[model samples]
Target: MDDTCAGEKSHLFCGFFLNFSLFGTGVVYTLTSATSMRAIQRANCYHRDGHDAPCSVGGDAYYMFLFGLAQAVLLQIPGFHEMAGLSVFAAVMSFFYSFVGVGLGVAKVIANGVIMGSIGGIPMVSTTQKVWRVSQAVGDILFAYPFSLVLLEIELINTHEMRFDQMKDTLKSTPPENKTMKTATRASLVITAFFYLCCGCLGYAAFGDGTPGNLLTGFGFYEPYWLIDLANLCIVLHLLGGYQVYTQPVFGFADRHFAGDAASVEVPVPMLGKRRVSVFRLCFRTAYVAATTALAVWFPYFNQVIGLLGAFTFWPLAIYFPVEMYLTRNKVMPWSKQWVAIHGFSLVCLLISAFASIGSAVGVFGSETS
Candidate 1:
């Protein structure tokens, strides 16, 4: 890779997609938090009233605003590195929720005494509808690549270089940075894939053709009302940290670009260990949260939005860029076996991304029109 050329291109694509991914994630999280909160309320209502009673809950706008308020407050954390504890806490919450979901699925399956779904999946759908559903499912699964999203953040500009350096500084010198990163990526991917499979398969087995987009909030298991409530609460808490994890890089980028002639101003907050924070960070992040909140309220189709964002960004950021970088870095000769193989892989991924994007676009606009 020509250092200058690669650097410039990296800056362009990374900046745009990183911002897009983070903004979309903020919107998704906002909607998800609202859904989870609503689920909690509905769970309580169902438990109180009979299961057959009319326990309908209304708009999610209220919960969205509440989530936005929470984010505005939590957005005060100085930078990405400051969110270590928050990330850990969020991970714990996620594990708890995942476990709860899986457990509920198992219990439901046992209660039913048979796996609910068929090998064919949703038997009555038309061919076109099935194709669209399959494509959206692909996109939804691709949306699970938050691991790549985080790596993209660490691959951006000077701020990311600083982040990279921080990681190096923390790691022991024996295994080397490349090896360590690859290992960690593999491990994270494996663990994430396992959890996804467990939850998805079990949920399908339990609910079959009637499965909802989300296992926890879809009201699949109502008898364990308290457990469902706790699971949704964990989702809310997890998303609270998740929003920061995805957006802090954007915050860092803005702080760098928008640092005009004005001298940096730091205000001391006695509550937060007397840590001084930038006033610009406060204003900018608050506005960012508000914008995302507004978008979430405007277009709140969670699954479609996730599909669009994932399919739209997947190939370029996750596949093509990385492959090109690798080929360039290793000086792979054009049309050589390695080059052809790598490009072939990228081409296949590009096609998949394209298909997914079309499906997701249809879903998004279709929902809007209807």
Candidate 2:
């Protein structure tokens, strides 16, 4: 951002958006974890008491606080380097649950004997309402693509910069980092799109316009209660580590900018000698977790919150900055074909983002009011 933008705009806007996205992710993850926990309880209740029973597992506050406590402990893991194992575990759990969702959806669709859902999707009271829903749906989709900031954590892959030095040594034999990253990104996108399409299309086909926002947790499938429990468990486990992945960057930044070399406290262990802990990291991360949990408890509207965050950050962080930086780097002429095409694309995305923002704002505020 500093390389591309002038003056303090980078710090003001980029810093704000980056931190906001990370913080917002923590909030979403907290909500999701609580929701999943509640789903597990409700699933069990419905299974034992029958699906027709009122298995209303209300009050996610306890679950939210539990998740927050887990985060508070995990965030003390120092940095992203320590989270490699956790990341792998989370990835595995994510794939496990995604497959479960897909499989369940397929089974339900098969039982239904006909593909459900119309091309227009669920009908609304008015055209305006339908447009709002479509816009919010666009925002939800856009939310999945803003991991650009996560790539910045590549800098933290090694503490002593050994990784970069090793890469530099292998530069003659190996492809450049950018090319390798792009290749990995493309492959990941393909894999992710496959699962996303399977889960989404299958869920819609199974339940049509009446499909719940969440397939597993929304009681879309009741017969396989044990499977739902397992899926929700996977979700909880995944979010536990996924939360750390998104928040580590923010924690690192705070350590650098605010804490620095100060605020150390030495605590002795039973077997090991005294180890120094950052007093600042402890307090800040704890407070941050608590805040996210509180917000999740207060406004538990999952889809609405996601849409608002996505719509808020999509254009600037995902489209505009990258486009502007690319143009600036290559010195693309203002009236040139390449420049015009890129700018046109950005413009279209900006309009879409604006539309999404309005719709998401409506959803969030409307949900709150109602």
Candidate 3:
């Protein structure tokens, strides 16, 4: 009887161990596959047409690195253990700050260009195609093309005595006095900024404060499903907005620059050619929608990945670009007091952001592990 019982116990233990191992392996596989898919999607969307190809790769890697860093920082927030709900909120907020501070700053010009193009009406898309095409285009320009240009420009400016301010002044020889264009651009920027701020704050409140996870249990509110859906919708809109801002300009420029063969080839689209819409415009809008949807579905949590990219790339562009342009145009000495102070402050912010991103990424990894 005793011998039989011992054998049965051993069999039970072996079975349990096998099940546990399988579960662990499955979880790791899911996370790995998801991460890779997201990264690849971002790469393709931004690096299409080989524009900003190299920077896209570097930017993607940097985003992944920051994600790891963000994971680390979230682990250390105060009251994290006692307030599970708040911990999530804090985590969300941290992610937003890290990305906006870093990624948004780096891609400001591309972001600006996309915004300009979307508003200015890139040949084919209607105003309604506004959400997807504009947002994605902005994202692409900032992460892929403008980033590469900025890096190259910085190198050139550093080597030569020619200041970045001078370059800006030369570029800005005449102020854009067109009231309509100026008004539209300003309006677009303000609206976009407000939208981003609201979403970021709400996202932080829901996830960081644990409201999203707890809404069902704590307050007798409707299921958290609604909130998640709403969040996703907001993200979708944001993506669309960025697409229009960035992609339209590039498409327009391409059409103009490479007129012969490229021009003859009808912009790719299904039926709308018979309508009054230009073939180029129709193709642009249709392509933008399809691409945006495909990418958003393929990489559902792209906002996080984008935030990570922004963390490294966005900040420099935001603070440095305007100032650099100012200095370059004025032809000031590189060592001037004004130059030192402005660049110094911007550099410090960038450095702190880099560290924070690293910390947050660590926290994310730890959470997944635990």
Candidate 4:
């Protein structure tokens, strides 16, 4: 293939890989958390209360639907890319909002810790607690971009494995069972992949060619003006889904385990500490969603940057975590030669992606200056 064609292919591959990785991570985390929460509810004899438990499948589907819907809207808005005059405000708002959400989540955990300590009369910091807090912060930062890529990788791997398993089962049977769902799913995958490929190609063609007005041309279809409006709506739904998913575990834990007068009841206090925090979180997340939508709209050219960052950071989280978890849990996958090769490949891809992102950022800025 020619250099341009090869570059386009590489970009497409990276985009698909990243999306699959990030989505996969989301699925795994949601499922595992749901399963653990369910077990906790059962063990505490709280299952008899008739409360509906959370499920990973439901959460995943909800977020996916929201994301798809948002993308559809965001691609249709005009002047979305030139609104960078509001970038600083948007960024600040998003940062504060994200910070509040993080703080609230952390505060709840700390409150739980304090209550446990009070019950036990323990006065010292435990090594596990320190490690956990540090790990949680690291996880938060990683999830910001890297985790998305990782989730996408996991999704792709899981899908491939499922297909393989289905094929194997069919071979083993005298007559295969109805393959309607599997066929439809595969068909959907093919169609989605085709559209994604087209978007990636159009994005690269519009920007990667390093010409004037390329961005405008690309935005016509690749980054389309309407995407901003769509993104805004999608983001709002995403935030709602995210809030639900994030709060469900904490609510579940509190409801099932905490007794009415346990001094550890971190119930939502009206017009007090909890309310203040909640308001801040709501404002922040709303601003964040708005800003992100605006940025994507105003600088349609940045879609490539977003894609690159999403792919680079999240690829490891998506592809490696599940494999690591599976190996740790089952002790089935031996550390063979193939494992070494995969790790090496992952590392190289990461480095390339990182450098390319930096280079692209510099180039975009340079072009604007000249």
User: lDDT for every model?
Assistant: 0.82, 0.84, 0.37, 0.37
lDDT of 2 by residue, 248-316 (tens): 888888888999776788855445567677889888988999999988888888888888889889888
Better of 1 and 2 by lDDT: 2
**lDDT score at residue 317, model 2, on the 0-100 scale:** 89
lDDT of each residue in 1-370, candidate 4, tens digit only? 1233235655455545544433333333332223222233232332233334331232223333344334323322222222232333333433443343333334434544532122222232886544433333233333333333222223433445566677787656332322543454465456545543443343333333332221222122221223322333333434333333322222333334542433322324434333222232333333433443343333333323333344345444445443444444544446567566666666765564555445445443544565
Give the count of colliding residue pairs in each prediction. 0, 0, 72, 42
The global Cα lDDT (0 to 1) of model 2 is 0.84
In model 4, the Cα lDDT at residue 157 comes to 34
Which of 2 and 3 is the better model by TM-score?
Answer: 2
Q: How does model 3 score by TM-score?
A: 0.37
Tell me the lDDT of candidate 3. Answer: 0.37
> What TM-score would every model get versus the actual structure?
0.89, 0.91, 0.37, 0.32
Ten residues in a row with the worst lDDT in model 3? Answer: 213-222
lDDT of 1 by residue, 1-370 (tens): 2364367867687668767987988999999999999999988998999778778788899999999998887788776666666766888999999999888888989999999989989864588988888888888877887566655333332344456677788654344546656766787688789899999999999999999889999888887788899999999999998898888878888888994543455555446654545667778888999999998898888898899889988887788777777887788999999899999999999899989889988888898888
Any idea what lDDT model 4 has?
Answer: 0.37
